[model samples]
Target: MTANAFMSISLDPPLIAISIAEKARMLGKIQASGRFAVSVLASGKDKIAWHFAGKPNPELHGLFDSLDGLPVVRGALATFSAEVRDEILAGDHTIFVGHVRALNWDSNADPLLFFKGKFGALEDTRKAPAGMLQIETELMW
Candidate 1:
């Protein structure tokens, strides 16, 4: 599923959380498998996100690669696989706390962001060393 309800819970033990609605199909899948993976989509991949959000986009089928045997978006900016460690009931959603088992990222790729019902990319406004900015963008696709 294309989840927007994810957050970092801790760094000491490398934990994260994703909120899934009680009735969501993914909830049971996570419960049964006791694991879940998150793919931080790269800029220009809104179609992939929309596809997973329940609107079928046949063009995006088979767009997954595997990490530690868990599915992740093929060109994601970052990916994380985790073991379900705890669950918290919150209103109509259950927050699944996960202990991160493995992770990989491309520091050069800009992240995809959903905001105000639209997808967008972040602006690089950091005041970094002149060559540093160019180096990061060199590998972005």
Candidate 2:
């Protein structure tokens, strides 16, 4: 399922958390499998996102690459596979905390963002190659 409610929980042990509705089918799938993967879609991948969001575009299906033997969206900006470490009940949602097993990323692609109920992309201001943004601490205002 396409989700926006996820975050990095820790760095030391490489943990991440994702929240799913208590009644969501994916919840049981995760619980049974004891693992899950997150793929941060790149910009222009709205159709893929929408497909996973229950829209079901047949043309966008099967666009997955594997990480640690788990499926991740192809061409994703980043992918993370994890094994469930803990689960918490939060009202109508369940938060699953996982220990990251594998992580991969490509800085060349812009990220797909959902804000205020709309999909968008960040303005690319860097003129150089798509890579880590270097901080110039020496530059002054």
Candidate 3:
């Protein structure tokens, strides 16, 4: 459940997007409050992710705190405080786009990665294997 929430907006005009289920309780809070902070989970925080994912936790209420007056989870690899700028209805998900106002990151913290329904960490010291190739095709061409 500890997935990389790549919550970011363009800097030119400044925008952010956070996708949430329409039935989620947090969605109401976010919409009513008009503000929310994205806390990027750090490595070793898989338990926290699972807890937030609603897997069941008895003692995990109010685990996050307010950052710059915005709600944020602590011990994140990084955190971004944003204000709601726009909301777009996308089928069963609502994309909450915001304007980033503040940001911070832990120097020694490693990012938690989520892929194919599993949690993992990025190896900071490992370099991309040599001889990588990518190809893009344009239909116009």
Candidate 4:
């Protein structure tokens, strides 16, 4: 399923979280299989994104590429296969917490992104790849 709500949840153990509507087909599959794969679509792959978002494509009928038995989108800029770590009920969505198992990435490719109400591409204003952004840790009173 196409995720609109997802984020990296941790740094030490490398975790990610995605919230899916409770009744979505993807949720059932995740529950049954105990695993799922995340593919970060490269820029200009909105067509592929829409295909997984429920629009049927006649030619590539169910053309899901796989690595280590996990279904992934071909040509993704980055991909990860993860085992389900936990499931949480978050109002109308079921949050699937995943523990990173296998990973792949291509830093040279720009990411496909959705913003506001439209699909977009990343514009690197910095003009160079920068390392992780640093934020000061908060101190408890």
Candidate 5:
């Protein structure tokens, strides 16, 4: 549940792929419902990320919100509802190719970033406009 193997596979017709573990409960739900949602958290929602990643932090309690019955991170930068288009087996995960059905975003919001086995926030650099902010401290284990 904490895994994030998702990627944008295409722009034409708005397609995305989420790699879910074969044993992930969410995978079963997606397959059963034929739909899924992606919520891209904004800076300050690291707890939300950790929460969904299967390690709920008590300090982040009550951080979850919803959109049309889909669990969404409160104050996320973006949320997308999609219909499952295809499923492909990949090693120990199943790649769920989704056709984005609806999407919403806040261009002004900085995104929560994950990389290199750590949770971090985007660092505003000369290449990007100023004012990127951190929600939670960079954490690695």
Candidate 6:
């Protein structure tokens, strides 16, 4: 039931969003709780990513630390404790959006990125392709 659940939302106001199955235990906790921590895993920590993705390990529970009454995993490249801003119903899943309230990080580490069903790290020195252009089209086109 794993999916591309991680995504960066609008940064101006510091917001993030993640999709969770309607039946997931985390859904209830997050919805009722109205908050959650976004821990950006450090490079080479695929196992840690899996644990939060529900890989099933008792020891994984201890990976997080309490900060300002929120839970965050120490050593994460970056951590943000966000308050729920919105919840949108999307078929069998719910999209939870949060506004960043607190944040901490080690600027030297690279962030773990999840794509195509696997986790990888962003290249520290790589820049975006020069002159890349973006095109926007209407949905009905």
Predictions in order: lDDT? 0.92, 0.92, 0.78, 0.85, 0.81, 0.79
| Candidate 1 Cα lDDT to native | 0.92
TM-score of 6: 0.74
**Residue range 1-141, candidate 4, lDDT tens digits:** 678877899987999888889879888999999998898889998888787789866666555678669988887898888899999999989998999888888888998999986899977567434776657899999
Off by over 4 Å in 1: 125-141
lDDT of 1 at 68: 78
Could you give me the TM-score of model 3 versus the true structure?
A: 0.77
Error of 6 at 47 (Å): 1.3
lDDT of 1 by residue, 30-137 (tens): 999999999999999999999999998877667989987899999899999999999899999999999999999999999999999999999978687766644434
Ranking by TM-score: 1, 2, 4, 5, 3, 6
How many Å off is the CA of 40 in candidate 6?
A: 1.1
In angstroms, how far off is 53's CA in candidate 3?
A: 0.4
| Number of the candidate with higher TM-score, 4 or 6 | 4
Provide TM-scores for the models: 0.86, 0.85, 0.77, 0.82, 0.80, 0.74
Sliding window of 10 residues with minimal summed lDDT for model 3:
1-10
Residue-level error in angstroms, candidate 1, position 32? 1.0
- Flag the better candidate by TM-score, 4 or 5: 4
Worst 10 residues of 6 by lDDT: 1-10
Query: By the lDDT metric, which is better: model 3 or model 5?
Result: 5
Candidate 5 has its poorest 10 consecutive residues by lDDT at 126-135
Mind giving the per-residue lDDT tens digits that candidate 3 earns over 66-96?
A: 7778767777888888888888989987888
lDDT of model number 6: 0.79
Clashes of each: 0, 0, 1, 0, 1, 0
Q: In model 2, which runs have C-alpha deviations exceeding 4 angstroms?
A: 125-141
